[model samples]
Target: MDYESLYKLIPKEPKKWLTQDVISWLQFIGLGQMEQKFVECSIDGAVLEDLTEKDLDEELGITQRIIKRKLLNWVNHGLKEYNEYIKQMKMPNLNNKKQQDEDFTIQKNIANSQFEQMLIENHENNGNDQFTSSVVRQEEQAIKQEIPGFNKFEHQLILQPIEGQQSNFYCVREAGAKIGRHSSNQILILEENISRFHAEIIFQDSMFALKDIGSTTGTFIKILKSLTLIQGMLIELGSNQFSVQKLDLLDNGGIEISLFVVEGPNLEDTIIFQLNKDKPSVALGRKSTVDISFPEDHHLSNQHAKFYLVDQTVTIEDHGSTNGSWMRLSGEGKMSNLFYLDPNEEIIIRIGTTNQYICQQNKMKVNEISGENLCIICVERERDCLILPCKHNATCLKCSKNLALCPFCRVKIQETIRIYKN
Candidate 1:
């Protein structure tokens, strides 16, 4: 009647572990339903009749042999995966130069196929060929991309106030988040106070913008890390959505602040959305979602490629971290270790040391934005210019002074190169 040992046998960390117990549990009871009941029953104990294997197979109309085989296969696979995880943990720390190289080789060999599958999936979702017609737009907007290790979901804030208690809610962009205004570094303005409020914010997909609505006491804005205030007056994000702030008018009025949680899709989902907009098919960097029937090991290291479709042109930039990123333009086979990317261009990101793990990317045309030929970066209009170091393109005078890098690709430049047209 003691299932504690069986539960303890399940590894704490199983990134690559199989879900045999989960499957068996599902068969005995049901998914999402009766989970607590089954856990209680398992604690008391599980009976063959209580397992519901036959009934489940009948409901699913599956043969008894298939269910039994699948269950057995999952158990075996789970054991193997758990053992591998243990083996990895027991290995010596790979830190020294030589050890690092060896670790990179080993890890890459193990993680390569998964990486390549991600790339292939990315390419299938978004290909570079789609950008053949559109010129790169100078006007800037926030877009999302699938970054590894980072959370790719949106978060919202929910505020609740206790009745008759007064509470104040102050909302600003988190620390480390950059802020800019009309080509100038400015502070965000706040609307006066209110009693209760709720607002939504997001950081995934490379977007770097925020908005505040009219509130009772007013909301203040500042950069995430620095004390630098964003320039200009306060502006709400969307036409319809309003920023919120709370003010205590009477007694016992306080609010509970909660964040909106957007659950991420399974690794099997090829295209990950950064915002609430339409999404394109994107390839995985080093992982792919295959038909569940096929073993995951089959497509592990071979498919590490990616691609995305955008309104005008696509851009890629190196994050200026430890490992250097590389690219293969148009499948040329020769990889270039440089920064920045454009439409129709294919790239491979060399992550970590020695470039053992590579993430490839291409462009696709399915979700093309309207107005491919329209170029927004010019000197004439009331355009906002983003300044950079090398001075490749001359952006609007307003836009240039506010940015520290080329807004198109975020490439850092040394000098403030300002080239205006006559």
Candidate 2:
């Protein structure tokens, strides 16, 4: 029999290492000892040239009836564990295929979550590695920023028009915004780094239309018009969501100038700006200042920026944008550009605007690691598992049921137990 098959035949768990079932399995495999030497030898792959029931009994120093009973039990136990593992492994793929057959709506949602996680990890690790704790924190931060506040909606600024500035707006989300006031037309002309901002401008009847700014992060629209049709109303677009019904911008300024949130989501978040109803209005002074860079001094911009406290390690990839990003390792150098990342490095992005894409280096201190308060499910024997916010911890399902408190913290979750499905 294959060693791998045998490995599965025996419980992989150390806690179950010497159970009666396991002993029985060894007996069935002819590894049980009447004399102890046969059992010892069998474990190391050595065996006798000739075999008989008495020989086996002699080898185990046990009676034939006892050996036979243990052997049968061993085979049964091995089969049970094998069947369980097979069932568990097949569930996820089978569920995915079944979801596909059912039109993939739910599967797509799950896929998108996984995809967004991948993209976020790529950004965190600069797209050169898999996710680590540092990378996961960045992704979780991105997710938090994208979908903050579970209950009601929220609004934020995208770009305030910058006038008479000779700055290059790299379509890479962090670039600054440009706004121009056409004196003769009396309209605000807002120009965003087309690469960073995302919008969908629908041309409707030249008078009425809609604008949906799809983004993974988020897009906000604040209408300054009191015409009831377009003023002070906040429009938000989620990933793949839409916005409908609005005015056209053919006549406002040389072009209609309106503020649009840019560079929040991934590539799909960028869309065209379409404003309806072109009206001549004098340039309104910007209520906000125009900066050419993100905040450079934020503490989050530490050299160990990618030190996520969650799953560790990640890869990075640059999208070939101007003003490249970099990673600053602690005690390494002032700042260095990178196309990839190791487990311990931090991340930093250079942008054209005053905003600094600085991420704080989360410490994986002993307290943080040991202070964690949840149940974890460890699946891979070769790798360590992390505990998520859910009450699950790293252990087999069978072991988990016997515990009352969170395994890591000993906090009593008396009436509740979190179950993880494949």
Candidate 3:
């Protein structure tokens, strides 16, 4: 679950929350790693509401002073909000007073609540339309308030004109939405590259999740933490994409996978690693020292993410990146993607401009890398030339002199830059 999703759930009230809800809240406060202790202590929502800072160290065994303070602050702030909400909730005095405004803002806030209320009322009043038009208008006046640019059709695909495409922001809906290029779809894109029924984003249990239908281009999302690694599957780090170049069996019965820089600037120089029991991980980022680097792709952090080759399994994890790392998702079988939107950030289901990349992998005249840090052509000498425009460095100065295409991403080499390193 995305941490911010928990904030939307605060409307459910703390006392009525379950164990998973408490766990979700822990992630919201960035203390999800220590939740086993919370589970061991059987700290449900009711108990969590009363938990004080002292109880963290004394009862939950969270010894780190800073962590305890952070958790304490989150708990206290949340309780304060809940308490204030309860105090303001006025119950009608048995027909002796006017009906109160339901204190809805105290819960999901007026924006989210009213939107949902409109949907629910629309659905409920479908057949039985007894209310007058004036009554409906009056009801809207009392409850309807839209945040400007807020409800610009969360999932509806706007007609795109020729030129370039822009980012699509979706509204969190109770009815959920179907996304695709089909004219009949709830969310539609005109890109011919996108499949007719590309994917679906559903809202369940007060959170949103994305699932691929049967799209050809595929849906991809960044790894917030870990993913069961698969060979051939593409991983998007920033402006580029990658896949398995080589997979080797380790002495410890685990497996090591070397990533093929499919499309991007190679800043790490090489993306080769020996993953034995001693080194069960491979790191990737824009930092030169990273196992696989794309130094020019500022969207990445020093260490964007990691690939863990365990004894029986392989997994990938996000190492606190700026733009985040992504993994391509396969079409419908399992839920595939559970998107817990952080109410703090915009919710984007990025199918991208599908047609532009539909033939990307197929058309690549791949000059696959021989090993990490080696020349793209000779596979022996150091790759030392920085191809201009793309900022890619995958070919040795000797090999790149006559090269027309930058070996990493196949972008035409316009100019060359070579800095000798001792």
Candidate 4:
């Protein structure tokens, strides 16, 4: 039969019927296996009034002869059932309607009674005003309690890359934050040198502190000098003995004492320094007073290069060294003679033929190092000093003294004691 003839055979209600109803009719007609194909046809709008038998045959993947005969029988049966249902809905018995109205009213009264009972129970529970007031007061007191050192403004950890002129800032929002290669950690370091769960920055006892969580490489902070204001003057008694008893008064009132002079490494040495907020700028070369001195190298100038932090960005600029300074960026196999670094990248500093330093935002784990004996900074010198706080024995005495921060964890080194073999 044609689509127009088949469509006219179906009742309007059956045309609006669901897929399940169509499936039921298909099963009743002994065509249950073909139900899925018919449902697909319906989804493609094949059940519409404009649908043709040719369209159904192509969509249902069934022959026109079989489908036409099956659909005609299904439609005839559905039309009879649809007409009877419509007639019953339109002419419901008056006796049944009255009975339904009465049943609805009774249900409404029962619901009202249940609602009133719930209200009475709620009122009884709230009658204990004293208990409620005490609970509210306790909550208020807890809110007012002061927590020391948790000044939101100061509680921030910044990871500044030594090579690249980029930094990552993390707000101390929670009690602690984990930093590592693990996906679960708040701060992720994807470098293979970092452990899965490397370290944690915790806010405890009103202080934001960094702790190394048994990482292969340790954590480090930049060492800063503790500044103290002294009111008294100093007297030069003997070489090592300074007698504060003999007060030397100045014209301005009290004389300030200069107990010791903190000097940079000697010119002939290779120094490793960490870039931090307080001391951001560092000069490297043959000068003894340079932040990072390379005194013995003739290829280096009096001031070879400068590594400084500008607004949290670490940048290195060559200062006219005779042999010239070069940098190799992260992931690069060969060292390039690049003058500047890209963002979020690591660079190896090379002066002459020696790889002077590896500049990066984060420290590499000890296990990530190919050799244990080599210094972490120079990579050429034998390691002899064990950095304190995060005890990773990774640098020689010369490199350790010059380092304000540990190369492994980037944490400030409190002290670096020399380790001697017996």
Candidate 5:
């Protein structure tokens, strides 16, 4: 429920936030205790922004003066910021029935797929379950074979158009991929705000690295680097997640934060911890050895990710894990064109107003809300390939290449045959 990141993901005029957006903000500001009530009342961003001091006590029943003050302050600040800066970030209508239905489908598919992977991973390789079903052998082999080429794998770049730029994938060879206004670049970004020699996404040391070679506006690649944590950030590591609220800046020169764990059914059974420069690096995973552990979450690797503190800023990095980690990527930051190459992650960067390449599923996962040719899996790119045998035109060339099973029927996919549509 990182509200800022969520807002960055689906930009809208502050007053136009969807219901989901409102829930996220409520959680971030310690107002989540009233989330059920707000949702039951069908309160959306537009309605939330319109609530007044009197309305809070009388209608909303937010009797606490402190709580009422916080709500009013948020509305006033949002209005001030919207009027002074931040354009009407113009994003697609995420609430449309079609869009919501598609999101639900994607969520459903992700859950089912994860469950299938666990079932497959549990099958012993000694042919113990061979006679039971070739399902294990077939799916496991496909996944193993595809894992090697997933990097060389061509994924789509889902651009949420910025006047002139259209969303398209520009595959970067082993050497590197450059993006800018120049026609010679691998990805030609014609946006006026972009510099001529913007930035380069290079594949090095068996991974992708991005470096800005002096751009006027500066290149701000989203994640896979040290991200400065602002107050009220919702950080998620696999199944374990927490909301960090910056408490105060130390007089001696540091920062303190209260980390509140947001999990389980009972809100009353909440857990809170404190973190600061005293703890330089904290490992996070399901293993008891890690600083923070989610023992019950099978999806998390023993050592999944890590958080760091440097110069009053908190940053995060994904450790080498069975499944990669990511967070909501959006908004802006002040970063120079520095080379960023994580041990994990395929190199993908962009120029222009904003790069809508959704964060990988953990957060980096991207999704295209609307488009006639959109892939059913990522839902961001065009449907350009069919699952073998079933031949269902469901996923884009990228997602199609990465699947071990056809998402639609859960059938073991023999191959993804590239197909073109009229």
Candidate 6:
């Protein structure tokens, strides 16, 4: 039989005996006597609305497609009845409207008499208007206290700019607050890079979360690392104290790194290096043996610095170069003589006059490198030839044989040198 026909067979007073029992509700909805045992075993204590087709097919041995479909239809009909039953239970009895009206009228009279007495008391106290205003304010506060989800100390999300100058704090009073270029958003960032509705900060279950909402540029959080210092041990960097135990340069795992020369003579330079999983360490230098080599720059030492990732923490130590290295902490514009870095900190490495920005990213983004270590001319073979004078390494040996000028800088190729990788 169809669901509509079976639904008609259910008793009108099923609510009196339903008690949220799945089997009883199914039976009331005209489920067959033979199928009762299977339904009971599958959903012994489930609610009517919670019943799904998958539950019956998987939990019960109901392999027949036609039988399962019919059973699902009946369960859907039962859910509708369950909703109606709940609606009926919550509905006030309109049959006793006259008595309800009388009760409301009596309460209204008592409130009005009390209000009149309060006004009289205020008048007797030398007509103190401030005292009367204070009582009204107190009543408003009491009403606010009775409101659902009202909080005096609402959680706030603070967005500090990368430059470390100013911060925007949002008092999250509702479930969520929008941050975008639009004025309608709770926090409006008026920048060309920001979209109309860039992101949303949601406060749910006493926890705050940020979600990017189809933004063109996308939203990013500056991942901050916590610092732990041992008692009586200090590695001073001007006013800051870094732990000596945390400064072990040989410590190694669990981090990927990307280095970029943010401010330098060559703006196109980018180096992406993944730490060795077994021994999580990377060396930066002018030497060819290092993981990352800056051969063009004379300012960098042969073995400039080393970055270590150990116990889920990242630390950097200088290799004692003639030109000492300096680090710029995250959110700061200026660089400091800090030799070590805490986890999640973005430090600008200054080797002599050259400045390189080192960022510890969640993953290594190789795609960010334009033309990605491949020959620019052929686009098939790896770039093994370095075009000298310009020092542009953007061509293979076969492609470099025909080219007179560098593909990148357009400088005359004094020599075409083939670079061999180990």
Report every candidate's CA lDDT: 0.27, 0.29, 0.56, 0.43, 0.54, 0.46
lDDT of 2 by residue, 1-422 (tens): 33344443442331222223345445646665532543342321111212345544654455658655654443345445555665554455654544233223322333344456466556866745454654576456445434435222111111112222422211111111222222221112233421132222222222111122332222222211111223222232121121222233343323322323322232223222332233222211111221111233221111211111111111122111112222211111112111221113222322222222221111110112221222223222211222222222334444455545544433444333222111
Best by lDDT: 3
**Tens digits of per-residue lDDT for model 6, 73-180:** 755664566547655645677797543443344324333433554666667786677666957864774465456544233333322122321233222322456766
**What residue runs in model 3 are displaced by over 4 Å at the alpha carbon?**
1-177, 190-197, 200-217, 264-270, 330-349, 353-422
- lDDT tens digits by residue: candidate 3, 1-422: 22234434433466645455678777766778987987766565656778887788787888898987777766778666764554444334555434423233222232343344455565677744543553586356445323243122122111111122522322223456776777777766677767788877665654556677767666766454477766666677876667766677766676756666665565333355666667778887779998877778877777877878666567777654545567766532322455454432222335643311110000111112113345645547875665655444556778788778655444567677663221
Model 2, position 330: C-alpha lDDT score = 12
Candidate 1: C-alpha RMSD to true structure equals 26.4
Question: Which residue segments of model 4 deviate by more than 4 Å?
Answer: 1-168, 223-422
The residue pairs that clash in candidate 6, if any, are: 253-309
lDDT, ranked from best to worst: 3, 5, 6, 4, 2, 1
What value does the lDDT take at residue 124 in candidate 1? 76
lDDT of candidate 5 over 1-422, digit per residue (tens):
24344343333455555455577677767888988767655465556767888877775688888888788888877545643344433334566654444334544565465456545555635555653465665456446534544312222222222123455433333446677788787767677877777766665555555666666544434343455666655454554445565546667555555556553222222343344656667777789988877788776778777777676666777554443444422212323434544433433234544443321211112323223246655547877775544444557889777778778546677666554332
- Report the C-alpha lDDT of model 4 over 280-338, residue by residue, as the tens digit: 56676677887655466555567765655544334455443334343211111221121
Which of candidates 1 and 4 is the stronger one according to TM-score? 4
- Most accurate candidate by TM-score: 3
Provide the RMSD of all predictions against the true structure, rounded to 1 decimal. Answer: 26.4, 29.6, 23.4, 33.5, 20.7, 33.0
Ranking by TM-score: 3, 5, 6, 4, 2, 1
Residue ranges of candidate 2 with Cα displaced over 4 Å: 1-39, 42-55, 72-93, 96-142, 145-422
lDDT of 4 at 351: 18
